[model samples]
Target: MINGAHVILYSHDAEADRAFLRDVLGQPHVDAGGGWLIVKLPPAEIAVHPTDAAQAHELYFLCDDVEGTVRELTARGVEFTEPVTDAGWGLLTRLRLPGGGEVGLYEARHQRATDL
Candidate 1:
């Protein structure tokens, strides 16, 4: 029986993604491999990175403020393909990673944070 899910994204630009996860998202991770650093994601942590493949995938991050999170990510030099906007479901924002993929950050007002 599966209780949780985790994903690993292969990248040629791992360092950049590593910095973005650690410095921007502030997720605690364990480092391994000298120049070949890999991050051990925290429980329930959702993360994204760049890829050369053409396949499309998505990752999500839960935030307190969608607007504030967008601002912070912008300031950090992360390019957002979609600005923060409110949909019927929740406040949503989309970002482009250096790995040629997209990640969505959402804040649901009607739903509890823990539920996400």
Candidate 2:
């Protein structure tokens, strides 16, 4: 049986990004070895979208309220690269990672599959 999933983010500055995930995001993690941290994520779901371009995978953090979550994260010193905007499926924005990359953040307007 499939137990769980692991998402990896390749970073130019791995340590700084790790610190952001551990300290800024306040994610619970355990050090594997040599300061490598494995983070515990909240409930997650996956979707398959048909595309004509090259195959790739993207990650997005789902929230209950985009504005509220943005405010909270801002207070914690997180930087957002974009303001939240309605995107039909959700209120979406991008948060900057310490390694100079951004990840999508959204509060979905559709039904959630987290209970599954």
Candidate 3:
């Protein structure tokens, strides 16, 4: 019965961030009135990780090639906040959004739910 999921990224400068998502990342979106854009992300997967400190949720964009994706995004003016590192489960990196928030990007080495 489950249909879909909606993810929210809180931002400081939402207009600028929205522009980046639309222009730089090229995320296809629809305006939900008053210029509020709702982005359509690529196929998604979810995982639950156990933590002892606190509970939190994070979002990451999956790719087939982290290095290549990074290269393409870099050419489009995306700023990577960290170098890509092999995280055992994937090759991982973080990219800075126009609003100063960071999101993880990875090429998964493990099974992905999207394959289902």
Candidate 4:
């Protein structure tokens, strides 16, 4: 009986990144004692892709409309490092995080299992 997933983003400036997630992204979170904020993510799904390289995982935020989402986030002072590009499965872009890292944001054109 799986409950939910907890994702961690390692950052050089943990406090700044936490503020970005809490304030900038508007994610609902709770102080998990001692100021450890645990964020509640949106609906999520996983997929398996083949690769020859070492095993790695990625995190992406999904939206129904990439253009609209981009517009809104841009207004919120979020910087997008990449313009949206159609990747067959979705329209993808990278948003620059406050700690000098980037996260993936996409509007999926493919069917989502989360709707099931």
Candidate 5:
């Protein structure tokens, strides 16, 4: 059985990336003495997407408040690719990071308590 999933992003700029993951992304994470940080991301939806990375795809944040999260990130200087919009089944928001990387935040139309 799978206990859970933990994602550790690789970055040449460790400090900046650490801060970005901690301060910018707002995930509850902890930095231990081993020069690694552990971020507790909410459970993901495992959706399909096209990406050019070594891995097939990336993690998508399944949020309950896409609008509020966007507001917070925008207030903190994160650039957004699009405002929260209805996608018929859910709400979607895309954010542009400091290194031109982007992450998608989503809220499902169907109501369900998240396991975060």
Candidate 6:
């Protein structure tokens, strides 16, 4: 039986990014060793989208209210690389991580697998 998923984010500035997630985003984490913080993610689900392009994996944080979440994060000094747009499946945005990586944030219109 599967217990959980661990996601790894490669960062140019690992220390800064860890601080961002721990302080700015207020994610609960524990130091793995020597200040390698492992942040705890919220409830998650996986999906497979058929694409003709190269195979890749994407991660997104789901929210109940995209607008409210955006406002909250913005006030916390988080920079959004993209404005919220209706992506058919959800209201979507991209927030820039301190490591120069962008991750998706969205409120899904489609049924969520997390409910299962």
Candidate 3 deviant stretches above 4 angstroms: none
Please report, in order, the local distance difference test score of every candidate based on alpha carbons.
0.71, 0.92, 0.94, 0.91, 0.72, 0.93
Q: Lowest lDDT 10-mer window, candidate 2?
A: 107-116
Error of 3 at 20 (Å): 1.3
Ten-residue region with minimum lDDT total, candidate 6: 8-17
Candidate 4 RMSD computed on C-alpha atoms after optimal superposition onto the true structure:
0.9
Candidate 5 lDDT by residue in tens digits, 14-100: 667667778877778777877677777765544466668666555457777888877877898888898788889899988765655
lDDT of 4 by residue, 2-109 (tens): 988888898888788888999999999999888888888999999999999999988899999999999999999999999999999999999988998888999888
- Residue pairs whose backbone atoms clash in candidate 1: 50-99, 51-99
Candidate order, lDDT descending:
3, 6, 2, 4, 5, 1
What is the per-residue lDDT of model 3 for residues 1-116, given as tens digits with 9 covering 90 to 100? 98899999999999988999889989999999999999989999888889998899998999999999999999998999999999898999999999999999999999989988
Q: What is candidate 6's lDDT per residue for 18-115, written digit by digit as tens?
A: 99989988899999899989999988999889999999988899999999999999999999999999989899999998989888999999999888
Q: Taking the candidates one at a time, how many backbone clashes does each contain?
A: 2, 0, 0, 0, 0, 0
Model 6, residue 66: C-alpha shift (Å)? 0.6
lDDT of 5 at 90: 93
Q: What overall lDDT, based on C-alpha atoms, would model 3 receive against the true structure?
A: 0.94
lDDT of 2 at 14: 89
| Candidate 6 Cα outliers beyond 4 Å, as residue runs | none
Q: Write the per-residue lDDT of candidate 1 for residues 1-116, one digit (tens) a residue.
A: 98767676665676777676777767777656564445555345433667899866666777778888788778988898986787887899888767666778888666553556
Provide the lowest-lDDT 10-residue window in model 3: 45-54
- lDDT (Cα) of model 5: 0.72
Best by TM-score: 3
**What does each candidate score in C-alpha RMSD?**
5.8, 1.0, 0.8, 0.9, 3.7, 0.9
- Most lDDT-accurate candidate: 3
Off by over 4 Å in 4: none
